[model samples]
Target: MLLSRLTGVSVLGLALLLGACSSTPEKEKVAEQPAAELYKESQIRMEDGNYRSAIAHLEALLSRYPFGPHADQAQLDLISAYYASADNPAALASIDRFIRLNPTHKDIDYALYMRGLVNEDEDRNYFQELFRIDRSDRDPHNIREAFGDYERLLREYPGSKYAPDAALRMTALKNRLARYEVQVAEYYYARDAFVASLGRGKYVLEYMPDTPEVERALELMALCYEELGMEKAQQDTLRVLKLNYPDNEMVLTVGS
Candidate 1:
């Protein structure tokens, strides 16, 4: 009985081993494919929205033929695949590698744009989206990085096809950043930290002019000045606010 049981266990183990080996043959076949064939397969997979499979094929092609004619295009496609598959870190690393290696490549603008998109997306996750939580008051580090990426893309490639979209995104980022500053100032002011609140408000005015939040920043600064007993500064801030926004509620109330 013991011998029969051992034999049955050995048979099950052998079947498992065979199943593993069978799976590897397909991978080996993929690895042996020429660079062009792998690239074509990856393209097909990408077109089918199978980004995970596309990433595998693109990575294999790149690893096997780093100098092949398709290498550059494969690298760019790999970044897209990684991003589509929600592998943000991999996408960013691939984008940086492509930029560092191909600084003057014709598609450098696209890489920069993708970098900005990835960073911007990193600031929001599925939970935030599902809950419809406002992200403007969150930490702005990723938003700042994305803004810088878009700014660089526009500065370096003014004539790029991506320029218009980059410019629009930059404007939105500027507004969001200005709003973030205002929120921080509000937090400080609520705590009676008038000096810190004033500094934050000044940051929005000086560095983030023309944003919609500028009016709010000015109002907050004036209030902070009042709290700190800085009458002259409060008057100056209110004057500027009224000049820019004659119908502002604070201006009308203070005048009354």
Candidate 2:
């Protein structure tokens, strides 16, 4: 009986030892380097086009030292890294968060510029691009979104370093929008929807007068007026088209 009790005690002790070992939690692998070191490593990775690794390092550094001196810059770098990695949705979210969190940040202009670029990149059409199709008939929703982003950036930071490039992009966007309007006018005219075509053409002439598509819009308006028996309006539109595009084939044909 004594021997059996001793054996039972030994088995219980072994079980307790195994239980204690199992219950002991493993230590987390601590980061040995400082946040600054991690940030530098991320920068190097980004410069070398290792954006994924750069993002990982930046994320780790931010988590470890959320309030460090490099936190804000790290956040900015993270956005750039995400963009470079083509993680556009994450980049956009990060940019918006940064803007909201640091409204008066010195680099807000850059953030806005980057936001515009990201939105614009998302607006590209694959088939249209591959086929070299005219953009006039393409969906303008994303284009409009990008245009709004750039417009807000310009309005908020007129003197920003990125203002000039944003201005150029805005001009291109306007021309595209104007062309889309002209295309719609042409489509309506093709379908004998004279009033609708005239309205769309007039909208372009009034709001997008400076665009190259203005000539086409005017031509469309003239054609619609001619078809609708508005002789006076048709003559007036033809004169305006002749004044702007004196050698235009449509003007020569329609004017005669």
Candidate 3:
């Protein structure tokens, strides 16, 4: 009787081990899934907002079948998945890779647009959002890169469906850049660095004309000129400011 009981326990343990081996973890099973199936699974995960899982599946599909029917779509979806997961670096890398490898891909314009968005969001500060802090004075390197990306999209893909939206974003980016210059001018002026302040103010007027910040730039230049004791230059700046913004407080107080 004892021998028979031991034999039954051993057989049960063997079956349990086999079951564990056959039931591979879902993530591990990704490697064995067919390319089309993997892509479909990724799409499902993406729809469900499971970006991390989608990323894994898309990446697997791309690796296993680089030249498969779904390769192109997988790459594009991977970029989106990375972005949705807040993985900016990975998103950028994937975008650059797509642009380089498939320059003539019908979806190239979409890749460019995604690249611009990733760069634009790269510098987004949670603190700024939470506190409503103005970030116009912050370093705008990423912002400039994003602006250039959109500019290239407009220049190269003029008729792309993304052109209209890109144009709008470009306008906003230009204004932000203009505001950055204005902030720098204000910083210099506060430190009594009138010459530097004047130079930055001129930059906005010359290169960033038509922006909403132009008036502020003009007022700042007028103040810089006044501080530097350049009466004629100050008068000229005030004349322009008054002509454009007659009701401006600076025009009222200083021009008067």
Candidate 4:
């Protein structure tokens, strides 16, 4: 019985010594990893729409080897992840970081486009909320930032692979914003703010020629001028409307 206990103790001591000797180096086991592997895995997760898992690996890779060969790719994927996860602030930050670090990258146009995505077409829901809650309005800053990024992609990287997509999105966004302007003009018109209505209507006609509201905008301008009893302006707005829409019958007066 004593011999058996002695043998067991000897085996246990040897096993403990081996465990101590074979422990992985702290850095190698945890924080350090092959950059290419982590990046590839992150990309795979992103392509599969597993954005949260992708972000986990990307954040780890970036923390450890930020300047590695996959840094730029990881940074872009991080932005996508935040967007997918609906974390707008993080998405903005990631795109900003990518832009600042990779201004000269061949696909920098993509980064610019992404920044636009984070701020692009301002949804009416958010706008209405801001107007309701904030007397101090900072929402316009985000709109302008998004617009500027799209404009930058157009100007600096016109021939980029992403330029076509960016241009399409930019046009769509511009049209939506113009529609907002028309809404304001209609509001003023309804309130009998004749001068403001005329000015806003003219802007829609002159600046945004492609919107569906252009015809109605001219009609509003004519009404405003006639209400203010400006004969020449009334005639001119009617003339412009008839010229633009030759076949459509126009009502020149409120009751008619």
Model 3, runs deviating above 4 Å: 1-29
lDDT of 4 by residue, 87-193 (tens): 67888888887778777887788788878877752332332343465322233455667767888999999888867877787676666656666777788999999
What's the residue-level lDDT of 14 in candidate 1? 62
Alpha carbon lDDT at 131, candidate 1: 55
> Model 2, stretches more than 4 Å misplaced?
1-33, 126-131
Decreasing TM-score order of the candidates:
1, 3, 2, 4
**Model 3 lDDT tens row, 1-256:** 0101112335567678568658544653465788889998999999998887999899889889999999999999999988887778999999999999999999999998888888888867644554579888889898899998999999999999989988898898899899999999989999999999999999998988989999999999998888888999999999999998899999898789
Q: How many residue pairs clash in each candidate?
A: 0, 0, 0, 0
Residue 121 CA displacement from its true place in model 1, Å: 0.7
Quote each prediction's TM-score: 0.87, 0.81, 0.86, 0.74
Q: Is candidate 2 or candidate 3 better by TM-score?
A: 3
List per-prediction Cα lDDT, in the order shown: 0.86, 0.83, 0.86, 0.73
What would the per-residue lDDT of candidate 1 be over residues 148-186, giving only the tens digit for each residue?
999999999999998998999999999999999999999
For all predictions, the C-alpha RMSD in Å is 12.1, 18.0, 14.2, 17.1
Candidate 1's clash total is 0
Who wins the TM-score comparison? 1
